[model samples]
Target: MKKIVIVLVLIGLSVISAISLLKTGEVRPTRVSELKSQFLEKATARVDHSKFPILQIKAASPRDLTAACLSCHNKTAQEVMQSNHWNWERPEYIAGRGIVYLGKKNVLNNFCIGVDGNEGTCARCHIGFGMRSARTFSYTDSTNIDCLVCHDNTETYAKAPEKGGAPEPVLDLNYIAGRVGSPKRSNCGVCHFYGGGGNNVKHGDLEEALFEPTRDIDIHMAVDGVNLSCIDCHTTERHVISGKMYSLSSMNRNRSHCESCHGEAPHADNILNKHMLKVACQTCHIPIYAKAHATKTHWDWSTAGRLRDGKPYEINDADGNHIYLSTKGSFQWGKNLKPDYIWFNGTAGHYLLGDVIADTSRPILLNTLNGSYHDPDAKIVPVKTHNARQPYDPAHRMLIKAKLYAEEKGQGALWVDFDWHKAAEKGMQALGLPFSGEIAFIRTQMHWRINHMVSGKDQAVACTECHTRADGRLANLTDFYLPGRDRNLLVETAGISLLWISLAGVLLHGSIRIAASRRNSKRG
Candidate 1:
């Protein structure tokens, strides 16, 4: 009984030791308050804009308020004028196309076509004033700048979409100007959140939910986590934003990267740390995009003009996202979408304006992410692959510019009359480019880089997600070989044959040893 008690005690002690070992190995989650204290402890602003006498006056127009601001900040407007935000033009040398000037004004996107003819509707996101109806607006005019759009702390200032990017008449300019301060999530989100047409349209990662995101939604922007603002990562120099658009910009000029804040070696594990050389920070950090809202993934222009009683028709998906629209055509939106992985360096190869179509049968690549495994600068990154079927001219062997939104109904507006030929002709005429007079729908795809709405480290994709699956996320990437995921027939057969032979040899040796032991026992 005493011996039994001793054995029982030993077993109990072993179980306790095992439990303690597990407890020690487990990592505890950081508290919200602790994380906030660590990352969001910023110094209070020194200069209050409300105290200034210039902001006290009742401003009649947005330009008037800008002029008042210029009285104190003399070079602010000039500095803004030099930025791509104001001019909407950035010149870059693309592969196969040399030194092409690209921007929102020049690039033909799947969404809303182009901004050439629809400046009034599209310029709502522009930072300047008097962009309505004028094909050539004055960029040098200092008064045309809208400072309240970025500086308004009151959140009362908002640009009217129909009013040519002007501040709403109901807005108290004096109150907004008095409360003028540095831009916040709300200030930037007013335009960016509602890009394309509505919320989560153009950029899959950017949405209104990022205004006050939770830790699970976006670790950096989380109210409980780092709570980083847009300006924190997109560090501006002389009013020019640092970040680069994959399709718009040729190279990352400002160099906003994960290493900017987090050092080169962020992960504690050696294996994960080594992945940083070939894998982008966002690839692992942001497992999925459009967490809060559904993002448009597909747009088919061929299905437009499905009307009832000579009027536009509309249809909605189960989640209430617009699946079909008479004005915009068909759309497919999804939430919590897995990103398309690609090898990308800083540079992008774009199909510039007037560039000839390479393959008429296959989907035209509007802009391709230029990179490979061999390229030292390249890394495997996550991107939102947006597919579309848009109008193209077979005769010209180029994409057709369709006038989507026009003031008059019969003036070659696809939205108004559902006439592709008239719209194509009008759009081509406006741009002074010759149209083939034959409009055909062609498949096209655009790769939009996913940089925002980052999830917590714990939510990152597991190794088995890609390393084990045959049709994994990285399966399409043929540039490099991945172990366990990729295989050669000879190597696989050799490995299997070696494993079987070793097992058979061990069994045979064990049988012989057992027979020898029996024989020795008989002799004894």
Candidate 2:
């Protein structure tokens, strides 16, 4: 009898081990298991979609998913109430309903009351906790940006199924939803890129630029060893998501970098700034480009000139615009005349601002000596040169070495070069733009823009719109702003392809399981 009991115990242990392996797909990593044990000693992984599911309530109704969430998080509710994210919607009396307005454009709110609020188009970003209804009801008057809104990844919640019950529950509810976590990309991208909506006077296209791979530009979030969430940089407070400002680090400012952290002044740090401590860092350390208007700080090229890409851009304006050209492979610029009017060819060879101009143009160049070039009356020379270089002129596009200086007087320039086609190729690679298709045009345009911005045209656009900023501003035009056929469709297609590929693999694996189960049963 004792021998029989031992055999039964061994068989039970084998079954347990087999179950764990099948469920997790690999023998759990020792470190991960240990961490999990320490954090959630009494927890289990919840697999059910219904128990802790997204409670989709209605938008017009008062008892909403948000209200339910606030029932437990009163302090967080206060924070949400004061946040600008909660006030994203506006009452559309013309339509006799409410509409979600992002940044300023109202027409772009696809998640309208007409769509019943719960539509995937609207619900993806505006969803409340425990939202489950076909039509979700949101508190229109209450502008509270709940903490749980974006951190709702109930899919990965792990807890002890028998003892701790349904994984921690989004709050402490009796639901068995999946565990969710803070966004590494998508959550922030939703608002950062204006829900990937129309190309209006918004901000840079963070949606497409956050994921691609390249080092064509620099921004605070794009710098290496400077990992921070959107909230960390954009928020007025830790939990607040208001007072939105363009992340200049992505543009070209190095003042907000890691090396500058804890220093008296970012641009004045002894180790980082190299010693021009008196000058306000942004005076010289400024953003090069981006689409969509933010402050009078961006380069406004909307009414400028036309490019090979069929869009209007500013011409190479005189003095205000620094005309960059390759002189002995250096990013050299014209001499600084009083009210120095420079017009850099947008198609000039790629180079850095600091490397080309060994001497900084000082003696206070502009009457409006503020850093940004976008001021309408910005007192700089206007660009009127059109298609300065013929489209596809191989000779006009060449590789040039350039250096960027931290301080005009003290710092030595950092050397870099520009290769138009190669830069475009590198940008495309970083952006994960399509390799074989009609996107070649977008790639071309994006390359030109990046070249223009880095060329330091007084009136420039952002490289991030086409290039991803995650890895040092990798300009990949093919991925973000394709040449023709509506760039939006290209982005959607890419996303769909990724989704379908993932789903297909999951389905195929499930099918194999069913077939194996059937075969084993028959053999038994």
Candidate 3:
């Protein structure tokens, strides 16, 4: 009888616990796990080029190897020929300037200016061989495609400096051609990481350190982390890569987004995921850039021509970084720095060569990053603002292009003769633009979107970092109201008044209840 009574009590207790759980809501939504990276599942080994008898022949030149690749991938070579890497030209529409052909061939940058007269040196980054001059370059040449440069598995091939994109003479063409495969990080880094003449010169986030990085530096590229390759994110179809730099491309198309891999709603909390509406993934994830090396933050071309003795000289800081040079100018380098916040909707406009500058008093925004807090499509993104004191045509109100590279001495190249007027005239004449003759130094700024050197969630920015009134990352964004940072005088007074009224009402209700309870007790 005692055992029966104990069992009945336990059943009653279980029923009460179940009822309590149901009332409190027992079901919870589970966050799905992130899918594996698609590139990680791809086959690594395919098409042994060494087995092909055509690749065994001793190649006399880089073009001979291209012919062998064409024998199998004739269709692939055609696709490559159409790519921007080969032609260095893309038809794009700008905001004010409509339907302009913007590319490295004609687009102007603060560093090195443009590639019109400097094709011999600048064409080293081009995929095809023999692009000595834009006017003289034959885009129809099929054999000009340097197949071994991108496909070289032996890592023995490289484009020689100032050789019109030809492979280095020291490379064993036959050996590299036999072992051809898809491009690795080193192949892309060879030109990209070292662009603007040295390591970490152009893009701050991309550098030599990305070859093999730790998890702290870049969670995506880290060997111990996901160990992702450039091709993984770049995701090429035929030869057209998906990602395009706004520095060259002006369109909103063909961009790589973080959502490509991680879903739009990756966070567990709804509050955190809602931030994806206005805040870009990079804004919160990439707190700093140039993780391992210092990037050039400033360049003063006004101080470039100063020479030591009769010869051009270079100066390095205690950290062995170029601080000043007779050819380039004075530079300011920064390492692991925070990026400037900006509202970007992907569309951008550039001050193309020969385009007149609107204002002379303020710094010329060489490329204007257009967006506002009101735009629904726009999101806050982090960018590296590269500032420079570049040469300008004050009379024409335009940024001037100077002849930077010279094949021989006394060719009016600024690097060789140190004559700004002669270089400007020569460069302008080559591009079919009139030179103003009056050259003046003017401050200019260019924005490079920071996408790489990403950090994981643990290293991501905290809420207080951008929520505080002072030293906030998004403090410069004053157009919209940010909670915890922004406070209005009217709202503060209304909130305080409401709080005092609620407190007085609570006290009055308590006193009335106590008085009623006392009256009831006296009547009893």
Top candidate, metric lDDT? 3
Give per-residue CA lDDT, model 2, range 6-48, as digits (tens). Answer: 9999999999999978977856445424433443332333544
Ten-residue region with minimum lDDT total, candidate 3: 30-39
- lDDT, candidate 2, equals 0.30
| CA shift of 461, model 2, Å | 16
- lDDT ranking from best candidate downward: 3, 1, 2
TM-score of each: 0.88, 0.30, 0.89
Q: How do the residues 162-209 of candidate 3 rate in per-residue lDDT, one tens digit apiece?
A: 999987888888877777777887888887788778898988988999
lDDT of candidate 1 over 252-318, digit per residue (tens)? 5676888876767767677998999999989988899999999999999888877889889999988
Runs off by more than 4 Å, candidate 1: 1-39, 133-135, 501-524
For the record, the alpha-carbon RMSD of candidate 3 to the native fold, in angstroms, is: 6.2
Number of backbone collisions per candidate:
0, 68, 0
lDDT score for residue 51 of model 1: 83
